[model samples]
Target: MTIRFPTLSFAAVRAELLARREIALLDVREEDPFAQAHPLWAANLPLSKLELEAWRRIPRRDTLIVLYGDHAGSDLAPIAAQRLAELGYTRVHVLEGGLDGWREAGGELFRDVNVPSKAFGELVEHERHTPSLSAQEVKALIDAKADVVVLDARRFDEYQTMSIPTATSVPGAELVLRVRALAPDPATQVIVNCAGRTRSIIGTQSLVNAGIPNPVAALRNGTIGWKLAGQALDHEASRRAPEAGEANRAVARASAQEVAQRAGVKCIALDAIESLEAPDRTVYRFDVRTPEEYEAGHLPHFASAPGGQLVQETDHQAPVCGARIVLADDDGVRAPMTASWLAQMGWEVYVVEDHPTSARQVRGAAAPVHPDAPVVDEVSVTELARHLRESPGTTAVIDVTAGVNHARRHIPGAWFAIRAQLAQAIEAIQPARRYVLTCGSSLLARFAAKDLRSLLKARGSEAEVSVLAGGNAAWFAAGEPEESGWKNVATPATDRYRRPYEGTDAPAEAMQAYLDWEFGLVAQLAADGTHHFHVI
Candidate 1:
């Protein structure tokens, strides 16, 4: 039975959005290709991992979902629509002309992930006139050893990769929390930067909004601008801002709380969060602290969503656009600062005020336990290696790691498979007496093994299933040899997409084109008046 998906035109989709309707504009492609171009509100829900992530991202099965892709004679959109139907989505449609159709309809297409928030940041700067300093001016200040502190507003890993000569890693959300300790003197000029313009502008504005005492400015266009200006960047920089003293923490907390209050962000008690979780409403509880801190201990029912990344990738984290968001942090500073921006971005956001030590806590990978997880059997890496050596053709080894990780390295004989396409993948493989599943950390592998066992059982097959304990990490730690590249793939390698601006091998023209697209986002925002952004 062939299913024909209903198609929605670009004009109709735009009308639905402008009318404040609840619709999920899903770009059913891998992140890399999706990053090349997409509409501002389009969320990347790659068909490869749809089964694993669909239920969590789009919680309401009845929600309106319009799927699109490159669609140059490809079945990606139709296949994705079928998958959504299988998952019980009631209102799913395919975009009429796909990406090309939208482009022809005079719609604005943006490059890179999180285009909506990034474009909004650009719009904010255009409206608010966020202050900035050129790379050359910053370099002159560094040479003269002026009273200035350079704060890299990107993630720690990005700052470590490449940074200004004397910049300290103080990610965007931390600027309000840690700036006072880094610069006690009121006269010390502060500069914030990221890989590009968005984070730099937002970070500088965050401090400015909080009424910080010191003069602050963004490194105009950030590292890309520095490279364009021919300024040398230091690699593997380890400098970081110091922790705040008690007095400074008090001051920062007061300032951030005031800013959040002005932005219409609410502060809620732990007990009050439950009332917000009724069936009629969707509420996301997040710990907006660093990953390390969240792992040590965090309140139960809260997912670890580092503040800066959460703000940068809100669509990915909380796909339910109109849902209420509650942020938590042990220190009072981060949540309020993050919530302030989210409120301005038009989210009904809140911060957790009092910390409760009585709540249960979990550690490490934070994998959600499946109800039938205990039924799956487990095998150690050494045992799997021995089984492969003793009975090569009888046992099938499937690596369910992310596509990019599998491409970099994997067990020599394992076939790469997407967890969502388990049944199709198993059918494609030669029938075997036994199967072993593994991923980067084995958390997802356990879930996959349970699913595969149930599927094989329903089919009346005698195949046994087990997960490799500790997964690929244990395989490497056990001194086992591995292979690299996209050979022996059980499914298409489309699970992961390659970014156009990722590595040095990318064409210079593509990189410049991406920048040019970003430069014109303000105009596009004006054309599409759906974004409800208010600059504070």
Candidate 2:
């Protein structure tokens, strides 16, 4: 039987996605293009890995799925819908012309999945929603020392390179999750700002809609607006957010504990970890550190897997759910935090006991290295660069560093690949060639190179892999030209990850209270609205 699929113009598709609840918007573009920018609800599940990687995350056989690709000649749209149908998904649709169509329809894009512009548009449409002080008003607030929290919702790197004075980088998606962490004082009003209108509006309203107890508003037009208002931006700070108070710290500690208990997770010393490798059991040893750290030197047999995401999505990370998962970290920060969360997520998680000075030295002299590990040769790198400069087939470079370093300066062609998204991020890449992995430091670049090489080999590809000898730091140190045209790409997600207790339909009273808290955005809640909130 011929399948007659649903088709809609980009405008119609987006309207349906935004107006409806629980829609899955899938972008079949290769990772680089997807990273360039996309809609908030859209997720990148490349057409290549549609059959393999997307199954577990997108299990619904009848999801209201919308697929798109580059407007040019990419067949990803129909192909993806076809694949989803084969996987038993009954309702599959495609955006007529991909993002180009959206742009043609004057639709805006965002940097991260956390902020939904359509939702923001809804907020702006309401009578009660007021624009925060314009750039002029904000500058006055800064001048008057007003009690407002101005948050930069861009990546941390952008915040570090240039940002409004006293601004904090609370990445957009994390805005709601980390709201309490950012604004502990109930009396402090919150202001969300991004580079432009879309993220600022979306970021602000997302916090409001998520039931944050703060009077929330967007920076009018964002940083650009601030600049046009003749405001001077600040740059290069070594300062970090001060440690939270005892109460907040306690919450973090407790959250970690809950995560650990739920996941059946534990932390073990290096020696204890050493005893568990039964040789036959497929124990996955992951190094939850930056690629630079991993490459410079990592524990023997340890593959690079950064921490933030390891905890957030454990199942996608540790496929062997019951396998003895061992993590390696140079310091306790990520390892413990990650282990605690993994435990909460139902994993048998553990951290290697202390014995090595650095993550690299954890393995003894006899640890086996994957046979096809990438080689970090200077000669090979020079040849690769020349090849890139010459014919220039699509080549992608990732700069995995703190937001500050990346914003200040990064490799010319590298896109943002923070360590957190390493494993899932790879699916965004085309399976054609081995990647040129890079980071701020050579350690991570080397680690990424090896990891990518191993991944390719496992897939039966003989792709050549290499790492920049010194990463982006070296690229800058060598006097390469640095440009300021880095474009923020849109990242999309599924409603599947959102956990609201009870059911898909939130209680109207609870939702009313939630809207009230988020709408007025009073920093602290009185006894009235607190009852409806339950952490899922």
Best TM-score among the predictions, by candidate number:
1
Q: List the residue pairs that clash in candidate 1.
A: none
TM-score of the candidate numbered 2?
A: 0.40
Task: Tell me the tens digit of each residue's lDDT in model 1 across 1-536.
Answer: 56998999999988877765667899987776787778888999876566667877777677788999663356478878987897888889999889999989988877778877888789889888999999899999999999999999888988987888999999888888899999999999999998778889889999998888899999987877777777788989999888888898899999989999999999898889998867545678888888888888888778888888888889998876567899999778899999998999888898998776555266664665222234468898888999989998889989988988998999988889977568768877888889999999887788688778878998999888999998999999999999999777787765655544333344556556666777898888887666878878
Worst 10 residues of 2 by lDDT: 527-536
Could you say which candidate leads in lDDT? 1
Error of 2 at 485 (Å): 12
Off by over 4 Å in 2: 1-25, 30-42, 46-131, 146-149, 171-190, 197-217, 248-536
- Reference-based lDDT, residue 288, model 2: 68
Per-residue error for 366 in candidate 1, Å, reads 3.5
* lDDT against true structure, model 2: 0.55
lDDT of 2 by residue, 1-536 (tens): 44667876766655554343334677776555664567644666665445545544453355567778763353558756876786777778877666777777766564322223223333342433645658888877778988787887665665776677888876553454455767877777788876555456545654554445677888875666666556777876333344445565455444543444444556677656657755433356777655555667776667666554344224344433234678776544345455643443334568675556743664323232222223564324455466567746546565555444665666555555543234455666554454666666666556455555656677787766667776766666766655443442112221122211112243445433333433432222121121111111
* Deviating ranges (above 4 Å) for candidate 1: 1-12, 69-72, 78-91, 96-106, 355-365, 369-400, 413-438, 441-471, 485-511
